[model samples]
Target: MAARREQDFHWAAVDRGELVVQQCRQCAKLRHPPLPRCAACGSLDWHEHPLSGLGRIISWVILTHPGGKDAVRRTGILVELDEGIRVVSNLVDQENAAIGARVRVEFGEPGPQRLALFRTLAETPA
Candidate 1:
């Protein structure tokens, strides 16, 4: 049997320790929340392209309420990747993530499954 390809490319990127996004081979357009076909050109030909793993914390929300059974206990962020793909994911390795802070992708077990979690990147002294 073929390997269980992830329905979401974000998960697939996590598996590879890299942040990636889908791009249409025909129109050369970038796409987020991966789909089976290109939304711009309606082409089936596409490929996964690695991102810079750099992004800004556009917006975030801390969930105080539980999501019921099987929900991973964590905070969420609506990060905008360097390539301009905005995706919602859990932020990790920080006491608190704030808006406009630099974040990078880190793979870890958010629940029973491994996933891509964003963390604050160290700032270099100027």
Candidate 2:
């Protein structure tokens, strides 16, 4: 785990095919984009914990001209995890993204690092 920041741990976890978040050991609160200290209680004692990889789409944007072909091929979403952490990542395994959609975290190769992205879970036919 040669990560410079807290989010680096999350990225590292994703690289290992796991979803993790920063949890304050003192306050037992989860934090995203990992901070040096817990925002809830200013606790520097923290640990990385695995998440369920389930979340709902809170916001999203479609990039028509994302500066490159690969960028344009993907869609982005801001997902609110069940633990209350919101992460902005690309949505995979789908053709389009929609609001209020249920999503799960997935690992993908995006540049030199392993990245986490959201993939739409298959919907049960109504």
Best prediction by TM-score: 2
lDDT of 1 by residue, 1-126 (tens): 766453566676678788788889999998887888888989989888888877888888766665554344567888888888898888895466788888888788856888878988775311
| Worst 10-residue lDDT window, candidate 2 | 63-72
Superposition TM-score, candidate 2 onto the true structure: 0.82
Could you estimate the TM-score for every candidate? 0.80, 0.82
- lDDT per residue for candidate 2 within 4-31, as digits (tens), equals 7556676667878998888889999988
**Clashes by residue pair, model 2:** none
Error of 2 at 112 (Å): 3.2
